[model samples]
Target: MLPTTRSLRLGFYTLAIILGAVLAAGLAMRHAERQALVEDAARANQQLALYANSLHTLIDRYRALPAVLALDPQLRAALNGTVSTEQQDALNRKLEKINGAARSSTLELLDRTGLAVAASNWRLPSSYVGHNYGFRPYFSQTRTQGTGRFYAVGVTSGIPGYFLSSAVTSDSGEFLGAMVVKLEFPELEREWQGSDTLLVSDARGVIFIANQPGWRYRLLQPLSDSDHADLKATRQYDKQPLTPLEYQSLRRFDDNSELARVVGPDGTADYLWESLPLTAEGWTLHLLRQPQVAFEDTRNAALAAAGLWLALVFLLLFLNQRWRLAKMRQRSREELEQLVQERTRDLRTAQDGLVQSAKLAALGQMSAALAHEINQPLTAQRMQLATLRLLLDHGRVDDAYKALKPVDDMLTRMAALTGHLKTFARKSPSGLRERLDLAAVVDQSLQLLDARLRDEQVSTVLHLTRPAWVRGDAIRLEQVLINLLRNALDAMQDKPCKRLQIRLEADEQLWRLTVTDNGGGIAAEHLPNVFDPFFTTKPVGDGLGLGLAVSFAIVHESGGRLSADNHASGAVFTVTLPIDLEAPVSC
Candidate 1:
């Protein structure tokens, strides 16, 4: 039963081909992973650049404020002599006005001895007035370097802010004092929307700013005794506990970036840690991201390499066995092209159907708002008619006539509301944008819900800027506004104290509208999915949970953004739309 020479040769060839394919696949997978890492590093570097720019822009904005204030004649004159109580009051008022205008955190005028003579926050409990910052390094650096910058936690205010200082001198060139401006970074942290961990570590390797919670004040490296002494002297991160971030470098891509296994507050996890030196502030911006690879790419790479190897091995066999193999290959290619074309057409049709169906579903889901808008005007007309009857019965013909006019107005409003609702029920063209007043949309939504608000006894606060024009479908925008208003009302329905605030203002070149409610806020876990279709926290029978989803789509369709967040009291939904330049400016 021993195999012949030819059979044995074929068996050996088969084993060698299998081994070669396996090696090729393995090598391809490794290459895929390395390529993925390279891409991730590129993205991380770009993100690092953006973050560094943000930090630099923030510092540069306030860096000149202290310098400009130092040149003030009043500040120079005050620093030259002892500041009396009245002069201190005048300086405080001036600083307050300037701080408000500049939108800086807090400004303080310090004497030559570094005692705060006047501060913008003089009225607050943690005011900086009378607090001497003589021990801080920024004060000394200003005296020596003429200008200085330091980031620290304010000992008096218990708030963390970047301190920018400039020297004040007299006509004789004598060092008079330092003008200091404090800049807090809470807003900046909130604005960093990256999913990766962003940490800003100072020269001492202590992280002072982080986008992620519980990451701040952690040390990138162990602080030396001198560093600890300096921290204590400056009270840089006062009252904040500093902890070591236990980590091990797994791989180094370059000098500034690496892959690491870190035991952080969240948990033990691996991250691609990238660092950028912020030379201006003596801080290092670090971005920690988990390495991510697409399974599809790896699998395709392995398949492609193995297929190429196998095809070469089988090429001569196919040519020797079947001279018609080339014809079959050409036929297969044609079939594949036809199949792809068919699939593309089918997919396009399906997508079109889905979009149309979603639009219909969106309108159908707004039955409650439609009912309210129509019924509100009807109810108002009924009450006005009753008043008219009473006045006519009491021989007050003028009052009866006046009341009838309101009833007529209500009927006209009701007709318009129903007309718009009917029009919105039909599918409109894709490019149905119209230049309309965003403020008017807000007013219309509020009018529709006014009766509901009164019924629920919810106090309202409105801060609207008039003539806020934007390009969008008026009815669709109204629908979005009404959905936000309705959600706010539902949130506060069971609250003991119900308060709803609606604000519409200009932000940059966009019209920003916010709807806020006091209803104990949304649960943290549910916040992310609030606008997801069919995502609802209400009782099963109460809703199908499509309002916010529809509103989100409508806003996006109008080239706008819709977002939701939890505030101290409850949830706030913001709708941001680009301002329409073709429309008249706000009055």
Candidate 2:
């Protein structure tokens, strides 16, 4: 018996459904996790905003100190160049006292003539003291805005620091000079240190300082080596465990806070980090929380849940397969019992019905072929009858004899056609292989569609190069071609520019055949699924959707491949068959 297409299709769809269900379940779980993560991120962003405001205020206070020093009367008189050496020393000593309290890196005062008149900790050369400080942005801002604050490197200190300066004026309210102070970061690192949090203050683009211990801050970026070394040394003072061997994850967010997650070597405790931004540069104030206290139970639960889900899936599959097999066996027994009780006539009737169903499926094309096939014989019979009648009317016996020969030939041709139809309609026993010319099979297929093609004003271009042979059933190949041509015709039914082209070519290895139509092209998304059974773009009731799929199966069974692609103008389907050179061409 030929394999039932319906059963095979049912099995395939069942497998697909099972796989799709498993994939959908996994995707749903992943989506839930993603939604939870998004919620956490929103909360983190809210906390970051509060931190930014606090840091901006602290920087403002540092700028206020420089403005107070520039307004001192003692400093103004000395800057005016009217003071004694003892008076100048006293002014310098007073300025040094102010700088020491701030723990600043450098301090200086400059007069209206751009002359530095006072210094702290570091001294300037006598000739260089009166040179221009007006050219620097810090001093220029102090002159323009009367008070300015920014981070800049020292001209003399040669170290990166914050420069806070402001304009100075006399009691008459006339501008006299400016006072500037530089606060070096190494000093700040000592005072602003935290226990658990690694802190870094990046001024403008440079990281002037960092406070952390050892290799804990080794892999971080946007910080210099000196800053990292300082941070590592500070962390060591706290007696915290900081090791490079740990698999640590440090995340630096846009808010400048760093989250450090460290997985220790022994796996005894993982780290969970929370950071609060600094009140000074919006930099981080981190707190590393030991995760063993919080997430150990959650991790164990997750592992257990994952294990249970996998076990459940396998159990379900096993139970489902067992149930399906039992059901299949039950159905098979019922079918076998029915088969035993079925009469011979019933079986024969069923066989005939199946054959008739196949014929009706191709009825439209078959009707066109039958009309063309019978028309020639009927025409010959009519002409002979007319001649016989005329010969009898004229009483010409010899003429009637010649007409009898033609009449016999027409009847014989009609008999041969009926015989061919019987063979075409019969199903060959399974596993029977025959060597046949694929080109002749194609010709027979075209003959079935010839009348319809002509009626639709569709023309076919045939390029039968040579005898391309294949080891396959001719009837099966013919059926595939008939389906293809009919589909082509239906596709072009509404096209104003309808054309069909079939080209056959062969080499030593393969037989290549292409059927092309100048109709509306298949949509791009539909191309891949065009061969799938029951997938049709056609309107309802227009197609059963099994033709191309059946055609695909037929080609595959013959050790061939069939593919459809969208052409620029329409759709083209090509078939490649492995050819047998020794096979004889069959009519």
Candidate 3:
């Protein structure tokens, strides 16, 4: 036979639910990927800012060296007076000593005619002592403007460095020569070797410094005719080609970030390009980072979360379906049983008679305990009434009145015991909820059991620290406490050292009452069945085994829990009741 229409509909609904979950999960993954990209871009921008600051600090450190050297008396004197062989040698020694201490690439004293008179590298094979720098812009610019800066490849050493120049002047304010300091940043470039690509470009869109050597001296944009002419005239790059880097802006995220396809020396790939402007020096720093790893992690995390959510949804659906099927089977079984009962009405009547007989037998078993409980008060009342009658016969009215008081108290005690038995046998009340003091309820329960506790020689301890207000029926709560106390007392009846402890604690959310007894603890095998209906460890006729079950139901209905555990010395029962936060505080 084919599946039913209901099964087909259920299958379709399950498929739809799965498809919808997959779609939502895919959207979430995409959103996570985009957010990761944005965060990566922000981190790249911060790195660019740090690199820019480091470069600026590196350059400023050499800026003051040239001006300070311009004020040296030996260099000024060598330029102003007639230069003999001895004087030139002395000037070279002075410049070499100063350059060595400053850790600069080179320091030179240039005459007004732009010819190097003394150089820091005079000891090297390729010395600049007699090299003419008349073609260099730093020489002429400093002569006219008092100071100048330039970045270019060295004509003598063929090394790239920045040149800082300051004009030397005589006491009469006559321009004599210029002091030039060459600052090379090989260490700075070495420090930038890492995963990220770092580059700095001048205002003219020409890259001067880069971690990758192939990227250095590349032009970000095509140069104008005039700019090319100026570079040729100054010989700044010294015959090096100013190649244009192949890059296309694929997408722009914001003003500070973009995605670009860059053709590097190795190959072409996409990169996240982040830029920060160096406002102090009119330069810009760029950082290129790969986004593949970050995007992959985001995708994985989203899929994991989606998978977990889907699993929970499927589990819940399966449980609900199983419960529905079970209910259907139960209903069918009940109908069958009802039909059978109707056919065997006379047989059922006989069975009912047998059930009543069994109930009567159970009542007979309980009769002994009940009789014991009621006998003490009844016997006391009888004796007191007899004494009262005797005192009245002797015409002692005052003594008779005292005797009558004792008889009345005993009768009242008996009435209370019977009332408790009636309440325990009846159905639990439905709508008698009120805000009641939990401490007072506990005290009342303890008072009802006080005589039994004293008779059994059980030491009682109370740790009620403060008022615990809870919402529930007072009678029901008291009944629960009374049952627990009676059970604890009964459990310790034969123990050598009998002790019962009750504690009340409350927090903002709930009130907790703990009842502990020293009864050598409950047996591990019987613990799980302790709260089950009609299941107990006591002898058959000793208990009906419904006390804890009834207490558990009452506590659960009142939005609380009743739990039992074995302590080292005995058994512990805890009752947790929800505190009525909105109720007025009471003492």
Candidate 4:
């Protein structure tokens, strides 16, 4: 069989469930990934901003120290070659005192010849006393450009720091020398020691400051021959090798944020990289933040969400399936009920047809009996009229009066017979029940078939001794009798002895009418089909084969049993009706 609607619906719902689960999973994964990315970017940006602000504030705080120190009369007089050796020594002590309060690594005054005129670290072992610092970019650039800044390893102290310088001058703007201050970031590196990776790179992409010592002075990019030569001449990093850090830019979000894969001692790891420009120092600050924890949390949340979504989808599908099943069941029940009603109507129509067929069969037989029955009474009345006329002609008025009474009696009998025939032929009411006389129904039926029975030489014997009453439609009961009598007549037509016997008997609970024909018994095989419609042993034109079948149906509808059996000499049909004790008995 083809699949039912319910099955198809289930199949469709199953597909939808699978698709919905897949869709939910995909959405959850995407949402988690997007959320992780956004959070990482925001965090990286915030850290970058903080680092940049700290670096800027540190630089700005010390930026004015070099310019202000350049204006010192002692430092200026010593750098102008106007101060004596004792005065230069005094200026050195003074500069050392100032450097201690300024938190600067070194403070020195150099002459226009790039020779140290005075220094703050003159008393130290690694000092700048009498050192020729003209090879330094800061000193040379400051003499030419009036001010300069650079990151380099100090030639005298052998320590790395950012150099800031300002040229010294008289009121006439003559270049005397330069005052320089060295800013070391050891404290800054200590402050940055934590989980986050912080780096400051110079313009050439050389990492100048880093929290991790291993990353300091490393090249963020590859060093070409030109950059190598420049670094060599400047001695910016001293003897430090500028190795390129293993950093690969995987994806860039914008100018400030990017995803980078960095090869480290542990393994390759991804980091969200954010950068900010240090405009005053011509450098950049970078912050590398690991997002593993955030991503792990997001993954767990996404899985949970996907699980919840799948469960909800299943619940909805289950409820929908239940509702659809209920509707289908209701629709099927209604369809079954309608089909049953149609079948009931068909059965009622067939019952009505059977009753109508029995009536028509009775009418056919009555046609012949009606002529014979009317002719007899009519003939007797005509004879009586002729006799009355004769008596009147003989002047016997008393005798004529007696003849008139006999004629009137004949007319009354004729009228009564015609009335009964008319009643038998009329249409029967549907589902009507009333008190009825069984004997009268049998007499009326026999009266209609009387002429036909005589023509067939069939003798009918009635065993109705008294009136038997039943509750039924009178016309239908009469039709049942007529059909039985006609069948008896047809059965005995070819037999030498044609006899039909009818008996009406009753008990306390039941009344029965039996019609027996004295003809050859029906064939054993054909007996069972005797009451079936269109089943006949007579000639085709002689009978329509509906007589017994219709009679059986009529009796059955009137709450009676109709049965047929073979007797020793012929066929017997019996009808048994339930007795109605409340019915009045008639004589």
* lDDT measured at residue 100 in model 2 versus the true structure, 0 to 100: 61
- Write model 3 residue lDDT over 449-550, tens digit each, in one string: 878988888899999956788888776788789888988988898898899999999756779899999988888998887877556788855665666877
lDDT of 2 by residue, 99-186 (tens): 6655455577887765676677635443224446565656667777786555544444445556678788777777777888766556
Residue-level lDDT tens digits of model 1 in 347-460: 565556556555544544454345456446654654565446434533578766766657666446534653443233323333479889899888877877879989999999
Top TM-score prediction, candidate number: 1
TM-score between candidate 2 and the true structure: 0.34
Off by over 4 Å in 4: 1-23, 303-308, 311-337, 341-587
lDDT of 1 at 291: 86
Model 2: pairs clashing at backbone N, Cα or C within 3 Å: 55-279, 212-231, 213-232, 213-235, 214-232
State which candidate has the highest lDDT: 1
TM-score of each: 0.54, 0.34, 0.51, 0.53
Off by over 4 Å in 1: 2-12, 316-587
Model 3 scores a C-alpha lDDT of 0.76
Candidates in order: C-alpha RMSD to true structure: 24.7, 38.3, 38.0, 62.1
Model 1 pairs in collision: none
lDDT of 4 by residue, 1-587 (tens): 35798899879978886777667767866776666666667656755665665666566556657766776666776665666789878988988877776667889888888788788998888878788888888888998888888999876677899888989997789999888898998998888887778899998999888897577777777778998888889899888777778988887888878888987534688988888777657788888776533444444545555555555654454555456555655655666677876665555655565565555545544544554565456546545654464345336798678766676665465347535632543334445688887888887777777788777777668799467878888987886787777677766878887878888888668897889998777888997888764568876456545567666767777898999888999989889998777945678
Off by over 4 Å in 2: 1-61, 81-83, 101-106, 122-132, 171-173, 190-206, 212-587
